[model samples]
Target: MPRAVTLIRSTALSDVAEYAYAATAPADARLIFLAGACPLNEDGSTAAVGDYAGQAAKAVENMRTALGAAGAGLDDVISTRVLVASARQEDLVTAWKVVRNAFGDHDVPSTLLGVTVLGYADQLVEIEGVAAVLDS
Candidate 1:
């Protein structure tokens, strides 16, 4: 059976389909909380410095890897938190699109954050994910 994930959509919110406000997951589902996914390449180097879109893409790829390690996929995602440095909404929008592409039709709850700096030098975007895995 599929995991019971209910998305509450409202017309009151623009971009509601882009991300839900609330998601209800099956009680029997296994929840996975990931550490913030970084845009580090295989060699632990920042994939792209000062490039919000590239960093977001790399971070989303890492999140997908993280989900696979836990026996889940993008469809299992319940929510995501995206952080972009340099305190610009434009940066957040650019990164958000990358995240949206990664999530595809899932469209679960999400947050875009703007910050002055991140944990790593040359890092501009970070993504954290929450997922649920239900019985097959």
Candidate 2:
């Protein structure tokens, strides 16, 4: 069996998200599209308020849960899209740190965007991912 890898590249966007991603897998392979995940707790309440680090952590955790639901893990994640409410340099840096820490040794192709706002007024960050199920 052959494994597929995600591709990342520098883009014209801000320094935070220069990496662009594409899905490249066998035609017969199974692919999963995860919905946009926000920094919300299990109880459907916002996890962090005005805390970039905390919101980032929760967003990453939510991404992990989404991947698991698709029968995949962080290692199987091919691409990720991160949305940050604040475009401040400091906030971007802090969010990146949280994401990098969550991935640890597994680094997948990712894109980070600085947005003016998110779905929830308290949400500071949102994360979405794509994964591929391994062949049995």
Candidate 3:
């Protein structure tokens, strides 16, 4: 099946960033707005305490599961916002590296943020995503 999502890269924009600068989905596509996927295990505990990279990986894994349940996948994702609970740029970069590697060549548009705290105890990372899929 053909994907509805299209990632846009611009020659005018700097190519230093790992992901595309923008993306779009056709009007007929089904939009999937996923909740923030936290670094939590199935049992409700945080998966990686005090480990930014590990927590980011777990969050990406959870995001993938959520997308699959919604009849989408990483390739169908149009954009994402990654939240890391930290005041340090290094911490945010650590989390972003994991997420970027997870997406690989799909490289959807993304925003990385560093916040003071997250919802769950010992939670270090959360990923929010929007995916579009054609349903025909």
Candidate 4:
């Protein structure tokens, strides 16, 4: 069965269709706590060095992999936290676009944060998400 995801909207918040102010899942949903996903390459090295777009995509891909392990997909994602080093406007926008592509029109609630540094040396983006998989 497909997971039930509902996007909540309020007049106090911005009307961004790609993002939701809040999201809810079924009461019986299994919540999956994920580790921060980074932009790692196939060789286990960090990809998108100095490239926000590539890094964002890689990070999202990692999240997807983690969700798959939990028997869920992007549709099951209810919330996401995005961390970007330096927090440049262009960098944030570039990273966000890549993330949006990964989640498509799911309208997953998200928080974008700017940090001084991340766990990795050259990593510019890190994303963590909470997903719920409902039992049939």
Best lDDT among the predictions, by candidate number: 3
Return whichever of 2 and 4 wins on lDDT: 4
* Angstrom error at residue 97, model 2: 1.2
How far residue 109's Cα lies from its native spot in candidate 2, in Å, is: 1.3
Model 3, span 1-136: residue lDDT tens? 9999899999999999999999999999999999999999999999979999999999999999999999989999999999999999999999999999999999999999999999999998999999999998
Q: What TM-score does candidate 3 get on C-alpha atoms?
A: 0.98
Task: Give candidate 3 misplaced runs (Cα > 4 Å).
Answer: none
Expressed as tens digits, the lDDT of each residue in 49-133 for candidate 2 is: 8899999999888888887777677766778778888869789778978986787655667777899988976998888877776
Model 4: clashing residue pairs?
none
All predictions: root-mean-square deviation over Cα?
A: 1.6, 3.6, 0.6, 1.5
For model 2, the superposed segments whose C-alpha errors exceed 4 Å read 1-3, 6-23
Give candidate 2's whole-model lDDT. 0.76
Task: Tell me, by TM-score, which candidate is best.
Answer: 3
TM-score of each: 0.92, 0.81, 0.98, 0.92
State how far residue 82 of model 4 sits from its true place (Å): 0.7
